[model samples]
Target chain A: MKPQSMGQAVLIGLALIYLASLYFMSSPVWMGFTINALIVAVVALAWNITGGFGGMASFGHAAMYGTGAYASAILQVQYGINPWIAFGAGIVAGAAMGAFIGALAFRYGLKGSYFALVTLAFAEVLRICASSFAITGGGSGLQLRLEPGLSTLQFNDRSVVYTILLVIVALVMALTAWLKYSRFGAYLIAVRENEDAARALGIDTYRIKVKAMAISGAFAGLAGVLYLQVWLFIDSAVVYGSAISIEALIGPIIGGAGTVWGPLIGTLGLHLLGEGAKHLLHNAPGLNFVLYAVVLICALRFLPQGLMGLAARIGTFRKKEDDNA
Target chain B: MLEVRNLSKSFGGLKAVSDASLDVPEGGIVGLLGPNGAGKTTCFTMIAGFTRPNEGTVRFMGQDVTGLPPHRICALGMIRTFQIVQPFAGLTVQENIAVGAYLHHHDRTEAMAVARQVGKRLGMGAMLDRPASSLTIAGRKRLELARALATGAKLLLLDEVMAGLIPSEVSEIVGIIRQIRDEGHTFLMIEHVMQAVMSLAETAYVLNHGKMIAHGTPKELVQDPAVVEAYLGHGAAARLQEGHHA
Candidate 1:
């Protein structure tokens, strides 16, 4: 089998095992933890499109995520639109925002740290606007009226939400897998490797970057809609916070930046570690973040390529041992 | 197939390429030669659309492509190689070539196939799976040429492909260039190797101080007093003229 197909098989098998384990778990607490972790995984996977593949590290993905959440929430609260329609609108809004930012930054040749700061500024401006605007419910935030049903996108059962999140994560994983081997993905990698060379080879690198950003934004927006539906409330601070943006990119970095399964592995490990630290610290206010900082530092120091690189190294070592035998 | 007229470029007060022009007829090998800091690269960049000329026009196959971007010009069947080899370091040799193959083949399998074909043709088939960063300088140069060929370019602008090669390696490249030219591809090369340029190019243009000083067949160019003066000093040119008479 091709390496890509083998990877897909492994991902699908892991997903099946995860769903089975979730089905057997009776505790709502564990279920909630898994759901939240999976949500982070999805967001990180989306962020990888631009951050990892396109080599345009964005520190303000929270802006896209929050725009998605708020776009859905405002439509539902103001016009009583169906939640499903509002969710679609949120994805579109996120893509539009991504294109606007991409065009402005790329046109002016803003890159590296400057581009990252611009993205951060965009999120901060959006957060401030959302907090001050009356239409966005001001600082008080918007709370969706919970009408329990699949049609309403609200359910009494936690597993329903868990299953939906799992599907979304799975779809994102599949999309990433396809992108890893596609022509467009090659173009994105070429652009990332050497922009001038890519252009000389007949690639319009600007267009490719913008397209990757738009797709990334759309996925982030979808994650936001999922967050809103499950949590039933979203304040600007919660959705548009810098922490969300940081979390989106950190998972991929801690797993393996450019690999398909990196974000999922990274998110699961980070979230589980955070939850364990929280338990040990008696749910202390900021200790989880402190633990995250320590783990991030260690990951950067020892395993700069993340867990996937570690796994590959181990695999090679084992193969060498077998050859010696 | 390619025409550059009255091209000029200035980096601030320094004129990099001033009012320089050249042409490559279909299926011809054109050599661009100059001493250090002679603006051959600047002229090539303007023709390939990497840099806009201050005052000039670039016409490819009768279409004015003066201000078009590099990618657009490449899509119009003209491509240029870099002086410094850029082989996507993180990718495998085949994958690096596949990046250029992707321009024509949207399918990954097809692109990879083209990459394999190009790799074999360039004598890099054995290292197809090796990382591009692992290649030697000669290997990297061949990989660069393979990548340019993968783009299916009708007119290739090669910048110093023979700069650092040994005589044997240079001859190998000369043979490859001749084979490629025989297959009906046109090349405009910037070469410091006079023997390779003289052996390959039917017509040659000499640049001195950002200006076109002489143009002729390689044999004619070697005997030209002006060309010799630009390359060696006036005293050397006079000595060469006396030696010729003797």
Candidate 2:
């Protein structure tokens, strides 16, 4: 068997084992934690499309996330639209927002820190607008009517929500894996490494970046919709807060940026660590934030390439040992 | 075929390349000879669409592609290599080459096959899986050339590819360039290595002080009075003449 096929089979087996384990976990609290972690993982994976691969770090992904949440919530509460259709609308709206932001940033050559700042500013503007807008229920926030049904996407069983989150994260992982091996993925890496050289090699870097951003925005928006459906409530502060952006950034940084499994591992590790700290600290209000900051600092200092780099090194070391043997 | 006409560019106060015109016919190797700051690289940048020309037109395969972006020009079958090697340091040598091959081969497998072929041709087959950042300067230059070749470029603009290489390595590169030329690829090279340029280039153009000083065969270029004065000094041209006779 070819190595690629063997690798694929191994991945499939691992995924099956993970799903089976999740299916057996009966604790509601643990399932809720898993669901939250999975949602963050989805956003982080989406962020990686632009930040890690496309080399355009954005600090305002919350804008798209908020757009998705608010769009879905507004459509359902005000217009009585079906929850699933509103969810789809949110994804499309998020993609449009991404395209608009990408077009402006890339067209004007706003790169590096400037591009990051532009995205941050964009999210801040959206937060303020959402806070002032009556249709979104202003700064007090919006709440979805508690209609517990699959059609409404509001589930009475916590396990159902967990399953849906798992499916979404799995789909995102599949997309990320496919992108990591695709020709377009190669182009994104090239652009990230060196834009001029990529251009000389005939890669339309601007278009590639915009396309990646659009896809990233769409997934982030999906995460937002899922968040709303599960929580039944969202405000400008919760959905479009810089905290959301920080979480998105931290997951990829801790696990590994630009790797397929990095965001999932990173998000899971981050949430578990945060939860452990919260429990040990006697439910301190802001202790988890302090712990996360320390973890991020340590990760940056020691594992600059993140955990995936360490794994890659160990793999190489094992291969060397085998050769020597 | 590549034709650059009336190309001119200026930085705030300095004229980098002024009214420089050059041409490379089908299947010919043309060398652009210039001293430091003679605007050889600037001229190449303009022709390859890395920089916009202030006043000129770059006609590639009979299309006026003066202000087009680098990728557009590359898609038109004209690709260029940077003077300072710009390898995708994070990627392996094969992956770096595959980036160029992706222009023609959409399938990852086919692109990688082309990368391997280009790597072997450029003597980088053994180091295909090695990170490009780990390669020596000469290896990086070869990688750059390999990448350009993998793009299936009909017209290649190579900027100082032979610079900073040992004599043996220079000779090897010259041989590869010759082989590529023999395969019917047209190249416009900006080179400082006199011997390699003389032996490889069928025609040479000399630029000095952002102006074209001379254009002829390599032997004829070296013997030109203006070329010698611009490159060396006022009396150096006389000294060169006496040395040549001696």
> What DockQ does each prediction reach against the true complex?
0.56, 0.62
lDDT of 1 by residue, A28-109 (tens): 9989999888877878998888888888999999988999999999999988999989989998988878877888888897
User: Candidate 2: what's its TM-score on chain B?
Assistant: 0.96
lDDT of 2 at B238: 91
Candidate 1 residue-wise lDDT, B1-246, digit = tens: 999899999999999998888999999999999898999998988888889989989999999999899999999899999999888876888999999899889899999999999899888888898878888789999999999899988999999999889999999999999988998999999999998998999999999999999999999999888888998976888898789799
lDDT of 1 at B204: 94
Q: List the residue pairs that clash in candidate 1.
A: none
Chain A TM-score of candidate 1 vs. true chain A: 0.92
Give candidate 2 regions above 4 Å deviation. A1-25, A317-325, B241-246
* Native-to-model Cα distance after best TM-score fit, residue B23 in candidate 1, in Å: 0.8
Clashing pairs in 2: none
| Per-model TM-score on C-alpha atoms | 0.94, 0.94
Off by over 4 Å in 1: A1-20, A316-325, B239-246
Candidate 2 TM-score versus the reference:
0.94
**lDDT of model 1 at position A13:** 54
